[model samples]
Each structure stands twice: as structure tokens, then as C-alpha cells.
Target chain A: MLYPRFKHFIEQKKMFSLGETLVVGASAGVDSMVLFDLLLKLSHVWKLKLVLVHVNYKLRGEHSDLDEMLVQEKANAASVPFFRFTHTEKSEGNFQEKARTFRRSKMEEVLDQQNAACIALAHHQNDQAETFLLRLLRGTGLKGLGGMKGSSLSKSGKKYIRPLLPFTREEIEAYAEEHKIAYRHDASNDDVSYKRNWIRHEVLQQLKQANPKIVNHLSHLSSQLREDEEALEYYVEAALQKVSISEDFGKCSLKREIYNSLPKAIRLRLSAAVFQKLFLESAILSADHREKIDHIALRKEGGKAQYFLPLNVLFTRDHEKIYFQKENVSE
Target chain B: MLYPRFKHFIEQKKMFSLGETLVVGASAGVDSMVLFDLLLKLSHVWKLKLVLVHVNYKLRGEHSDLDEMLVQEKANAASVPFFRFTHTEKSEGNFQEKARTFRRSKMEEVLDQQNAACIALAHHQNDQAETFLLRLLRGTGLKGLGGMKGSSLSKSGKKYIRPLLPFTREEIEAYAEEHKIAYRHDASNDDVSYKRNWIRHEVLQQLKQANPKIVNHLSHLSSQLREDEEALEYYVEAALQKVSISEDFGKCSLKREIYNSLPKAIRLRLSAAVFQKLFLESAILSADHREKIDHIALRKEGGKAQYFLPLNVLFTRDHEKIYFQKENVSE
Candidate 1:
């Protein structure tokens, strides 16, 4: 079903010209296995070379080693380079953070040794949806809830690409089954101890059952939101051009009469933009915070007044002007 | 807690000029009851008019009549006009659809006979959130998800104002309790059978508990989205000026090379505008539908081809020129 999509992904990546070297992050999962085999089959047509990298964090003992062996065997059959690393640290301290750090380091090491152009990962649509939901549950702003990008530059300037991100897990499983690809299953996915596991197994499943098309609906929502968010960033840039001052203050001082003349919504966004620029971070600003700032700016007897923000930035209003400065000092 | 807010609302409404008028649509609910007593107390300062309008759809039999009596006694004690309505139809259709139609008709009748300048309703922040969520779930585009406006002209050209929309239900309940005002309970709110009720009782409640500031967060999101949406509409209007040919064909013939040179997200939105203009409807385009249309436009085909939309409009392309004409066509 997704062969055309996979072909499109390969074409988009210019995979054939990547020095015949392809680095795949193998998790011993069905999705990764399917991707590994598909790349292997397309190797001749695309004039490709394959490198498989597997990282076992020693969290699941013998099962982890067995999973690594399965990936090594698959690479051996395809006559490709296989690399495996076993970490002594367990998946205990911030499982996601630790795993991410370890995986990136290992991928970078393999890429450097092999002189690979890009590192490929097996993140799919379901994972993206999980990420979006996770961020939303934590009261994230729009950018945070945009899930993951399909391509980005790694810390060492190497390319990281997710070619399978647009496809679903079921599609991958179907492909694997059709091709008779051998893959190992991770038991941790069913443990349900982690928050992501809980959401993946419980909340998402329930939502899927309630509406079979929930994943598609949510993915569509996220894509639309991403577009809308890009448009917002464009406007914020425009608003900053008109009203922003300097990076240090990040303060846009406008005539009180002029600021008030703009729409209430723009006034709020302009305030948010100023706050974000001054703090050098984006956090959710409450309606109360917005109203307080509005009140301060519009105060009849406006002396110097200060309001505290999340990142210890003080928003100060003196007469008709508002400025964001560090929180330690009193005006 | 909300007394100051109520005071601000009355002053904002310029209620001093309107004397001895009825506060219609008083179901003895928290919103209406709070508004009723606020108007009664402010009668001295504003030389105000206060009356209660109650409509009994008779769906709940004795419970519905009891709600009406509660409002009548409340208005009687305040020594204001008490108007009661009984619906013969009982609104057996979609509860929301019927309630809205019947409520407005009743409001129109009272406003006409009593010469009331405005009909005040007690919709508050929670209602706005529910409205936004509903619009989101149903795939409404930007404008529908903007929640309710502060003031609007009713179908009959009467002024409709919502004074409490910025305040939460808790604030109104607190004000009612502090002022010793009696209110009726509506059991339908807890039904959980209706989609809106499910969202209100389950999803919103959970969100509120988890964040402890969900309303403010949602309101901020809404305001920000509204600003971004307005800015996008401005851009769309500008793009339309350059590209749009006619509404009949939804005919927007952009220079293909230039359109393709624009960002993919903008291209999608511009395409949506063409679809919207031709369809003359909102919420018709899904992500898949959009992708199909985009694929056709971006395809390698050099000749004319037809793409059918769900709304029965056919998009035809001839090399660099795109046409959104009627479905019956030999492209």
C-alpha cells in the first residue's frame, strides 16, 4: 500500500547519491525491520550501500542482546555493515532523555566512522501523534505541540531523516508480513509503566476504538496547526519588525494611544512577542497576565509597576510605556 | 469575587441610560441569576431596569416548570417584570438546534413587546471554551472556532450582548452565593450523553484539574489563534486580489511557477481559498482531500485533468493554469 510513498521518500532524499552509504537506526522492531529490508531490496536500483546500527542500553538483559543479534543477522544477509553498542547504564534516569542522548551519540559515532551522509530513523505517524499528545497534556504552546520534523541537522551537522514518518505502524507490519521479514519485539512497549506507554496502550487505543479514524483526524489537525503556526510566526516576525526594539530589552515602546488603537488581539500577541523576545524563551502566557499588563498600560495613575513572569523577567510599566527587564531590580 | 467584574460589565454596557427594562432569558441559572441580582443591586446607581425572562420547553415536565417558578419568584422579589414562555413543540429535534431557534424566537417576541434595548445572556468563559472545542472537533475553520463575539446583531436586528463571557462559572457561582441569590439546577448539564456535555463534563474538567488554569490557557490560545487567523486572512485577501479570476469557477489562476515557488504550507492555504470560494462552504477540505488536490496540481502531467472534490466541484488543470469549474466538464 505504501510502496509508492516509500519510493517518493527515497527520491526526495536523493538516496542513490549519498555516496552509496545509508545508516539505519535498528530498534529490532517491525517498522525498522521493514525499512531495513525495503532499503536492501532497492539497493541495486538506487545503487545504494547500507549500514545498520543498533544500540542496546542493557535495560532488558538477554532479550536486548537477542534483539541486537536479530538486526546483525539481517544486515549479514544483505551483506551490509552492522554496528552494535551496549550501554552499561539502565533505562532509569529520564528514560526518554537518556535513550535520546545515547542513540544520537552512537549514531554520530557510526556516521563519522563510515562517512555516512545521513542517519535514518524509524519514527512513524503514530509516534508523532504520541509526541503531540504528550506535549499537549503538559500545557505546551503551539511550537512544542507541533510534534517532530521529518528532517533536521544533528549536533555535529550530519543529517537526520525520518523517511517513514508519514506511514503508520500497521502499514509497516503489513509490509513486514508480506516480505516475511524477521524482527524482534521489545517487551518494554507493553510494560505501561512510562507515560508514553500508558498513552500509547491506553488513551490512544481507547480513542482509536471510539473513532477508528482518530489517528488520521489528529494527524490532519497537527499538520494544519503546523501550517497555522508557521503563518503565526510569519506575522510575529512582521509585528516585531514594526514594534520591536533591541534584543537586550526586546521592548516595543509604542504610544499608549496608538497601541490601544490596534485590535485587542494584536495588542495581546504583541505583548507576548515582547515577553518571549526579552526572556529568550516561549512559555504559555495566561489571560490574567495579559489583562494585568493591559491594565497597567492603561492605568490612569500609572507610576512604576512590575509584574513577574515565568522565567524571572519583570514587566514594568511607567506612565504609558511597558518594558521587560530582569526581575532582580526594583524600578 | 465577581462583583467587581459585574460592576465593570454594567459600566461597560452603559446601563445607566436604559431604565426599567427586563433581563430576559433568566433560567435561574448561575449566569442569568447572577446577572439578575447584579442589575437589581446596580438599579440605584444606574437607575436600571430589571426583569426575568424564562422559557419552559416542557421537556422535563415538573422540573422545567420548577425552573420557571424559581426565576419568577426571584424576579418578583426584585420587583421586576417576569415573563414566562411555554413551548408547544417541546423541541423534540436536536436539543441544541431547537433550543437555539426557540430561545431566539422568544427573545425576539419579548424584545418587541417590551421595547427592550438589549437582551443580555449569561454565557461565560466555560461556554466559550466548550464552543471552541466543539468547533474544533467538527473540523470548523478559523472563524467558527473564534468562539462567541461580545456583542452581535440578532437575526431580528436586536442587540445581543454577553456580559459574563470573560468570567468563569465559578466566579458567577461565588457571586451568587455571596449575595445570597437563589438559582435553579439544570440536570442536562450532567447527562454526558451529548457530545458537548461529554467535552464539558469529562475533557474540560480533566484539563482544568490537571492545569488548574485551563480556562485562562484556552482563552489565551483562542485570542492568539484569532490574531494569527486575522493576519492570515489579510494575506489570503492580498493573494486573492492577485490570483482570483471569478467566484463561479472558484477560478484562481496563479502563475504556476510562482505558486510552486512559495512555501508548501502557503500553497496549501491558497489552494484551500480557491476551494472555499468555489464550494461556498467551510470545513469541506480534509487533509487527504487537500493532498490529492495538491498532488494533481504538482503532478508531472502536462495536459488537462479533472479532480473531483467532496463538495461536487471539479478542479481542472491545463499545464500551468488551474480551474475550479463545475463537475460536468470534459477537461
Candidate 2:
């Protein structure tokens, strides 16, 4: 029953190109298992070549190995290509964030070798709702509120798509049950110590008491914000094009009057984009940094007023131009 | 203690000019009672000529009269001019909506007669959250998500301000209790059949179990959306200026290419603005009406593609220009 919904979503959103290779990120969880099943079912009709990728982080010992084995077996039974990546090293900082980075990089490596059209992930509507709530808690702007993009292209032009984003976790679980699909349940998911786990189990469960369709409403909100954000970004890009006077490898200049004339939203976006370009994604420019830049631009004083941004990027304004320069430039 | 926050909000938001006649809507509820007390305390410092308006709907017989008498007594004690408006007749349609309209009209009449600077309402953070939830449940876009504005000027440029918007209902109630402010509680508010009351008692109360600060967070979301909406509106206005060729009473002309070149958000806003201008507030241009207009403009044909927007306004687009004309005209 949900198959038609998935098909319609893919067709309506044009999530992937037909006759193209696709990489599915599977962890043997219910979400990934359902995604893998659906994609496999639609492969011949859509002319899709499915490839499943599983990474064994080795954190859970036997459980990790069992999950990987199940994913590989499912892929092999479906006659789809299966690949395994081993993670023997652990990184500092948040474990989830590090694992995501590792998985994305590994997937990108595979995508480059296979020239896959897109890598599909199993982020359902519940995940979207959780992300929305988390971002709200941390204080986010409109772009953050837009939540995850349905399809995004990486720096290497590899497309990443979330085909299950429109469906709720319950719906996916129901579909898996109806199809009698085999999946591995991760015990760590029930541990509410993790922020996302807490949100999923504690926060949303309570919210559901008020509105049973809270996840649906949150997903709808993200969709609305996404469209509104695209329109805003389009205008921001245009504003950037109009104000930009010159650009180099790690520097750019904008006419002061023209840049200041832009609305605050566009100004913040343009400045952040410039910082991201110069800093080469060292870190996202913080709201505080943007506020300082806003103040500098508003001041329009030429000499001795330097505004420092994230990743050692410093901006100084002149009577005519606002200059973005790296503090420790080698050249 | 909360006075400084209220004072700072006024100063930061520029809600109204100080030392001027200000109309306060006092309903004898705790929310309004707190607002009245705070304003009276600040009146001397801000040099404001405070005026209070109480609307007695007479729905509760003696209770209604008692509420009005309490408000009048409070105003007299504070040495503020008091005005009472009686609604002996009930209007058709949704009672809440009609009551709101009637109250606003009556307040406006008082505002005009007193030449007040602005009319202040006692809508707090809880009301804002409830409205946010109600809007989500009923299906809304960005504008609806933005909730209520801190200050808005009506069609006739009569200013209305919501000073208590930044404070939660609990905060207002606490203030009232601490100060021992006499207020009449309306028993009808406990009736959950009313959509807003249901949201307040059932929805938000349930949501508060998850996060005690949910009301504050919801208010913050509205504030963020308001800023984003402002930026979007700025771009839309700029686009309108670029595309509009001619505009008069019940008619407008716009360059097709320029209008189509604008982003969807801006296009919808521009078209809705034009429709509003032609119709003169006779009806609100709905999303469906705007979508139809968008389709008509995209078709690029002259005769067969007439769109009837709300309030009997018609739109037609040709190869070069989009024309807006009222349904009936003498010429």
C-alpha cells in the first residue's frame, strides 16, 4: 500500500534518474531495511541498479557483525551488489557526528568508483520531526528550520537523496511487517541518553498526546520552509551577484552601499556564503559572527574597525567596499 | 521586576511614542489586569496619557457587569480615563471572530475619539503558542506560522500593539498574584469546546509536560519567522516595484517577464498585493486563488486564461503583460 506512495513521491520529486546506479546506506535497522526493500522492488521498473553499503563500527561486537551480515544477506538474495566498510578507528567529539562523517565519506568514495547517480538514506518523517525539534531547541534561523533537504549534491557532485522522508516511522514499520521483511533492531536506539533518542522517545511521545499527527505537521512545516527558503536563497544569490565587485581564491569584495542596501536576511546569507567560500567549510559562521558583520556593515567606517569571523576570516569595511580577507594568508 | 522588560520591549520595538494617549483593552481577566497595572505604573515615567476601554458582551449577565465595574474601578483608582462599550446585540457567524471584530471596531472608535497613540492588547505568549498550533492544525504557510505581530497598523493606519506578547501567561498570572491585583476570572474560558480554549487547556497543557518552556520556544519561533517574513516581504516589494507597469483603482498592469522572473514566494506576494489593492480589502486572496493566478500567468495566453481571485478581481496575462481588472466596472 505504501509502495504507491513511495513511487509517486519519487516520480513527483524526480528524486533519481532512471537507468542509474544507486547506493543505499543500510544498517539493518527497520528504516534502512524498508528503504532497501522498496528500492529493490522498484529497481527493474525504474531501471535502477541497487548497491547496498554497510559499515561495521565494531562498537557493539556481535550485534554489529550480525547487523552487517543481515544487510549483506538481503542484498545478495536480491542479487544487488553489496559492499562492506570497516571502521576500526574512533574519532574525537560527538560519536554520532563522527560516524555520520565517516559514513558519508565512505559512501562518496564508493559513489566515485561506481559513478552512482545518488545515495539514498532512510531518514523518515519522524527523523525530520526530531531534527526540527532539535534545531529549534538550539535556536535556528529559517534555513535550519527548513530541516533536511530531500536531495542534495555534495561538493564532488554526488547526489544524496532521502526517499523515506515523507513517510512516518510507523508507516515504514507497518510496510515492513506487511511484507515480512527481516531487520535487526539496534538496542542503543532505546537509550534515551542520546539527545536525538531522548527527543524521539521522550519529547515526541509527550507531544503526540496533544496532536497525534505532530510528526506529519512538522514534516509539512519543513516542506513549506524548504520552498520558502529556496525562494529566499534565490533572491539572496541575486543580491550577492549585484553587490559583488571582485572575487579571488580566498577573498571577495562587495560595494558597501549595495551590500548594506540588501535586506538583513540576504545580507546575513551573502556574508555567510562569502565566509564559507573563504574558510573552505572550516566551520559554519555563527550567528554572533553574522551579527558582528551586520554591525560593521551598518557602521560603514573605513579604518581600524576589523570584524573577525569563524576560521580566521576577518572583514573590514571601507567607504566604498567591504573586504573579506583571511587573517593568516600564506600567499 | 517585569516592568523593565516591558519598558525595554517598548523601547526596542518602538511600539509607540511616549507621552501620548494610549488605549489599553482591559477585559478584567488576569492577563489584561496585569497589563493594566503595568501600564499604569509606567504611565508616569513614560509620560503617557493612559486610557482604558472595556467591552461588556453581557454574555454572563451579572458577571459581565461585575467585570466591567472592576475594570472601571481600577481605572478610576489609577486616574486613567475609562471607556465602556456595550454589545447588546450578537452578530452572525463565529462568535469569537465576531466578538473580536466588534471589539476592535469599538476600540477604534474610542481610539479615534481620544486620538490615542495605539491600542494595546493583552495577548501573551500562551495565546501566541495556541494560535501557532491552531494555524498548523488548520494548514498554514509562512505568514500564518509567524503568528501575531508585536505591533500592526490597521487599514486606516490605526496602530495596535501587543506589549504582553513577550511574557508568558504564567508570568502574567504570577505578577497579578504577587501584586494582589483584583481580576475577574471568566468561567467560559474553561470550556474546551472552543478551539482556542481546547488548545490552551488540552494541547498546550499536554505539550508543557514534555518541555516546560514550550510556550517561550514557540514565541521565539514566531519572532524568528516574523524577521524572515519581513526580509521576504522586502524582496517582494522590490520585485513589485520592478514589475509593476501601471496600477489604479481596481486595475493593475505588470510586465510578464519581470514578474515571472521573480521567485515563487515573491511572485505570490506581488500578485496577492495587486489583488488586494484592486479589491480594496473586500476579501483575502487565498493560497488557492494565488495558485490559480500563478497558473494563468504561466500559460502566457491573453484571452482564455482569466483568473477570478477573491473579491471579484480578475487577472489576465498576455505575451508581455499581466493585467488585473475588477469583475465589474463602469468603464
Candidate 3:
């Protein structure tokens, strides 16, 4: 069932075209190990060319190196091409942010060398649940709170695909164990100091104990949310089309009458859409910020500037016309 | 902030017409109690009349009677009419299901007595999240998993409004505590035997403890999902208008080519729409059910009996004419 579902997802996304290689990010974890093995088995059936990539961040010292060795041995057994990268520099900022940047950069390099059509990572359902929780903690808006995308474009313009995203971590572990697949253990996963780790070790375990199907439930929720999210984007696009007064040099103005007339929920979404167009980040706009913007559009006097935002967008009223633009540099 | 938002929501929905009384189902719980007080306060400003209705299921013995007393006292203090009903019959089915049915019936009776324009309930953000989780667990499709609506029409044709749907349970609790509003305690809430209660007590609490802001975050996710759900509906409606062969006598047919060409997500949504028109219930068409219909439509058969889903709706094929109608009695 897992293999068939993975095949269907890969084919549906067209993750790999004819003669184009796929770069798999193998972390030597059960999830990634299972994905790597499945891809190895299905490559002939699907006519897929595979390139294995592993990142040794050196954060775990000898353990990380051991994991890289395991992945290399697995790739050797499968007679597949493999690439490995080691990063010695300590990540200065957030561990999650730094790890993400490091992984993406390494993956891009592998893609360029292999000319891979897509980079596949083994982010299963539990990962999605953790992500949803993380985004919620950070006060994310609709898009940010949506968790992970099945297929997204990386920073370097390479396609990143998660074919096993809908599967739970437990399922992946069961598959790996049943197949006698050897994988590395990441000590950081049990640290609990990091938010994701805490969610994984404490929160998710408790939820699983209570329900025994928490990951599946959360994954289902994400898919449902994803569907709803797409529908919302359409309506927001429609509202944007009807209400946008001007868009020049990435500065846009939405007609006040049009903006004010929308329901508050729609108004908040529209505001987020406008900011997304300029900033390209899905920061949660506060309700106060939305209300302030609504006030500017409804009550503020002419020529008065009102700073309404998450991305610091400003709405300046000039008689009946509401001029919207990025805030001045001085302010 | 909550009161103002509630006021804005009620006014926007036009839930109560001019000179018509509004009935609120005030169970004296944190949610309904806050709603009761807020409506009482806003009634003067909005020029509206208010009536409070309470249903004591008598499941919790003394606790249930206490809740009724609290609601009646509060209504009396506000100089508003109060209505109370007690049910001695124990629920034979699930406790939540029985309570819901009883509450709705009581609300209807109160509405009739007051000639109310709408019946209001305090289903805050947490309730919406739980509903979403429950529907997802049950393998529900887009519409069922979409959660609660801000406004809906009851089966008895009475308007139902949930002004606090966007507000989180924490926010309502904070407001109630801040205003020194007295609310009753429902022992059943902590039972954790029911699926929703388990989610509320176990899953959500774990998420909240990890993030400390999970309620608002998940609620934001729901709001975004709602927007997406609306957008999907718009596209579905447009597609129905363009590709629907016919929609008469509670039966409809869609062009196979048009249906297959739609994005998979949209195809699932269209199936849901078609099912909804016939069943008036979104639960009948699961994800697997939609896929089955899609599979039937894709098969290159000339004319055959199409798959009939859980509902009594029978889908058949007549060469180019794909047909959907209620199952014939003789068959």
C-alpha cells in the first residue's frame, strides 16, 4: 500500500521526467531509509534514475559520520550514484533555520551535478503535524499555518518533493523494521529543547498514546486544510482582481470602498495576499493590524497616513482615493 | 475586543431583523455565558431585544441544575427574558449527539415562543478545531471537514448564528474572567470518553502546552481553510454551470471530459457538491467514494450502470448521457 501510494504521488506530481534523475535526500532515518529503499526497488518499474545525497552537518561528531557511512553502504549495495557534503561551521542563529538553509544549499548542488528533475525528501505525516504546531505557535496566517507543501520549489529553483508526506512516522518505522533496514539515530530528535523536538518527544507521543492515530488524523486535517486553502486563494484572487486600484513597481492600492465592504475574514485574507505580493512571506497579520487598516479606510481623514500591517504596508487617504504603498525608509 | 467583534459579526450577518427578538442558547458555560453577557451589553447599542434560553439535560445531576440557575440569574440581572427546559430522558446514543439534538430542539421551541429572528450559540474557535479534527478522523470530505459556519439555517428553518466562531476558547475565558462573569461547570467536558472531548482535553491541550498559543493558531488555520473552501466552491459552481449536463428534480449529470480535466482537488469538490445537492449531508461522500466515482467516469465504457454511493442516489450511463438520480423504488 505504501509503495503504491508513493508511486501514485510521484507520478501525479511528475516529479521525474524521462531520462531526468531524482536526487533523494537520505538522512539514514527510518523515514528516509524506507523512501530510499522503495525508490531503489521502483526505479526499474518507473524507469527512474536516482541520485542519493547525504548531508553530514558534523553537529553529531562521529555519529553523524557513521550515519553518512551507512547511507553510502546502502547506495553501494543498490549500485546507485551518491553525493555527500560536510558542513563544519556552527549555525549561529536558530538551529531549524540554519539546518534548513544547509540542507537546501547542499540539495541544490546535488541537483545541479546530477541534473535532477526533483529532490525528494522523506518528510512524513508526523513532520507535517509538527510543522502545523510550529506555525501555530508563531502566529502564522492562513498560508503559513498550512504546514508543508507536497511539492515546492527550492530556493535554487529546483523542485522539492515529499512523496511520503501522507504516511505516518510509525508506518515508516514499521516498514523499515520489517525489511531489516539499518538507519541512523539523530540524538537531536530527543533533545526536547527545540520546539519541534518537544512536539515530537512529548506532545505527539502523548497524543498518540491517547488516540493511537494522532499523526494520521493530523495529516488528514492538513490535506483538508490544503483543499480549503486553495479554494480561499481563488476567492482572494477574485477579490483582488475586483478591488485592486493600481499595481506599479510592486506597490498596490486596493479601493477603500471595495476593501471595507468585504467581510472581516476576507479583509484579513486580502491584507495577507497584498503583503505576500510584496514581501513573499506569510507572516500572520494581527487582528489589531487589520482593524487599524479598516479604520484608516473607513474613518481616517484625507492625506493622513495610516500604518496598517504585518509587512508595514501603509494606506494614505487623499479625499476619496486611498493610496497604498510601502512605508517610507525613514520611518 | 471580543464584544466588539461579536457585535460586528452579528450586524454583518443581519442575524436579527429590526424589532425582532434574538434568542441565545446560554448554557452558562464559558462560551455561552460570555456570549450571553456580550449580547446583553451590545443589545442597547445595536437597538436589539434579547431572550436567553437554557437546556438542562440533567446528565450531570446537580451540576446541570446549577448551570440553569446561573443562566436564569444572569438573564434576570440583565432585565431580559429567560427560558429553561429540563430533559429527564437519558441519551441512548452518544452523549454528544444526544445533547446536540436536545439543545437544538430546545432552541427551536424558545425561538417559536419569542418569534426570534435567529438563535445564537457560542461555538468558539476551539469548537471549530475539534469539529475539524473529528471530521478528519472519520474520513470526511472537504465540506464536512470544513468545520462550522458562522451562520447557517437549522432544519426547522430557524436562522442559527455563531458570532464567536472566530474567537478562541481562551479569549472567551479571558473575557469572562476579566468581566467577572459567572459560568457553570460541565463535568462532562472533562470526561474524555467522547471523541471531541478527547481531542479537546488531550490533543489540543498538548498542542497548546507546547506552543502556548495553539488555539489562536489553529483557529487562524481554520479561517484560512474557510477562505480556501469558499474559493473552491466558486470554481465548482462555475464548473457546474459550464459542464453540468442537467440539475433537475434533485438529480444532476456532469460531462466526463470536463470532470476528468479538472484538477484532482476540484474534481473531489465537484463530487461533493453533486452529493450535497442530493443528500443535503456532506458525510455521505468520503474521499474513497469520490475516487470510485472518478474511476467510473474515466472508464471508456459505452453505457453501463454507474456506481451508487452510500446515499440513495443512483448514477448511470446512457452513451454520452451520464445520469444521476434517486434510486428507483422497484430497483
DockQ of each candidate, alpha-carbon based:
0.27, 0.30, 0.32
lDDT for each residue of candidate 3 in B72-101, tens digit (9 for 90 to 100): 898888889988887777646776677788
- Sorted by TM-score (best first), the order is 2, 3, 1
Return the lDDT, model 1, position A134.
Answer: 64
Error of 2 at A101 (Å): 1.4
Query: Which whole-number lDDT from 0 to 100 does residue B12 have in model 1?
Result: 57
TM-score of chain A of each: 0.82, 0.84, 0.84
Stretches of candidate 3 off by over 4 Å are: A1-14, A17-20, A44-49, A145-156, A234-271, A274-331, B1-20, B28-49, B62-80, B120-157, B160-184, B194-204, B243-251, B255-264, B278-283, B292-331
DockQ, candidate 3, comes to: 0.32
Candidate 1 per-residue lDDT, tens place, A154-261, comes to 657888877787787788888888878899888888887666776687766755533666565555566666766676566556666655466554444555665555
Pairs that clash in candidate 2: none
Tell me the TM-score of model 3. Answer: 0.80
User: Could you tell which candidate, 1 or 2, scores higher by DockQ?
Assistant: 2
lDDT: worst 10-residue window of model 3 chain A: A242-251
Candidate 3 residue lDDT tens string, A1-331? 6788888877765666656688999988888899998887788876788989898888777899899999999999988898998877774677667777888888888888877788888988898888865665676655554556788886557799888987888788888888888998888888888888987888767666546776777776666566556656556677777655444544676667787666555666787666666655765556676656666677644656657554556656655655557665673
Number of the candidate with higher TM-score, 1 or 2: 2
Question: Which candidate leads the pack in DockQ?
Answer: 3
What's the ranking of the predictions by DockQ, best on top?
3, 2, 1
How accurate locally, in lDDT, is each candidate? 0.71, 0.82, 0.75
